[model samples]
Target: MQRVIVRSSRGALPTAAKLVAGIGLALTGFFTASAILPYLPAGTRDQGAGLMSMSFGWLIGWRVIGRAPQATMAGAARVGLRAALWLALTVLLYLGALQMMARMLRGRYHGLSEALTDVIAQGLGLGAAAVQLDVIAMLFLGGVLSAILSAWAARRWQ
Candidate 1:
């Protein structure tokens, strides 16, 4: 007789699809809170939050698709195309999600039009400059700090 059993990979996902989805969610949250939140006023927090969430999804697309492991030109091109498609889809979904969330949180925003305008204006004003700087800084800091800490933690944990 043959028996079947399912094995767990703990918190890890085996497939690329699952891994990308998980990374998208995590990066969205991290980018929103750590990078985008502080730049916005309280009333416009939701808008910034939404946009940041979307941006992270695109970032994940770039990471997964555009920056695949070094390989043949054809393989690289395929990965690039896939990444671009995923990035575009992620942006669209993010916008849709933001709109839905805005409707759900209608009461929280005093006026949709005015709040949106303010959000857009603020976004435009600091979007290109401050946000980019923040992203770069955060990436640098997080990369270095995490690497050091991860090494330390691994040694200790082992």
Candidate 2:
């Protein structure tokens, strides 16, 4: 075998860390907003949380992914798409995890012989609950804000 050298992209940790941070902020923000805006609709609270978190993710992705803000308009669109895609993927995974946890809590499907259809149906149902427009829109906006804020933070600190 030929000699091989392996190196990992340096941005991976920052990207993952930022994703976790953004998720935490979204959850905390939702709870805080729920308490502060007692009369706010559940949907509105969820939208606000998504907006805040996604904007943060956008900034994080900007810094981690090297899509500079000074690029052409098309470049900016690509950056936005990148962050949005990340969010979509994350949402799917998270929903799937939640579905699995819910099933475990019910103590069902513990056998190897269990039909895969049951699992797929459960996952799909949870996924459907997660794909609201307001949620998607806020996630996009949050991603945009993340791009802006991450750029600003990098400028200030680095």
Candidate 3:
């Protein structure tokens, strides 16, 4: 015989772990975006970029990392690293697509396909410009800190 466990809507209620993780990663995203700003080419304008990144980070932390099964401290660290990479990639893709759209609006691209393809190029260029030694160090440290906090919250609250 086998037993099945079912979860209800009530199970979806927010927990301390989720709140802690979400806020921790959200701060990380905001700081990372701020770090990237100075590296952007002069006259390159961005609106609400920090807010966008923070939202993504919160989503990933709350929905992804928070919901992930608890494990050993080492495993929690891995989850944090994974979340960091996801945040970085998601932000990169978003920025790329945004730049592509801006260029299209200016009639810089000829065709739709060409404009879409340039999204990757634009993202890569931004990554290249933004990824300095200090930025890399901050990102690495921030990810680790967020992970530790989330794991601690899980253990303490559970």
Cα deviation of 35 in candidate 1 (Å)? 2.4
Ten contiguous residues with the weakest lDDT in model 1: 142-151
Q: Residue 93, candidate 2: how far off, in angstroms?
A: 1.8
- What is the per-residue lDDT of model 3 for residues 1-158, given as tens digits with 9 covering 90 to 100? 89999877742878877888788889888898899899987655456779998999898888767775356778777888888888888888888888887888899987888998998998888888888988777766676677778778888888
Put down candidate 2 lDDT per residue, 86-111, tens digits, no spaces.
Answer: 65555444334445555566787766
lDDT of 2 at 75: 48
Rank candidates by lDDT, best first: 3, 2, 1
TM-score for predicted model 1 compared with the true structure: 0.34
Winner on lDDT (2 vs 3): 3
CA lDDT, every model vs. true structure: 0.44, 0.46, 0.80
The reply for model 3, stretches above 4 Å from the true place, is: 1-11
What lDDT would candidate 2 get against the real structure?
A: 0.46
lDDT string, candidate 1, 25-83, tens digits:
33543553456445544444345555554566445543553233223445434443444
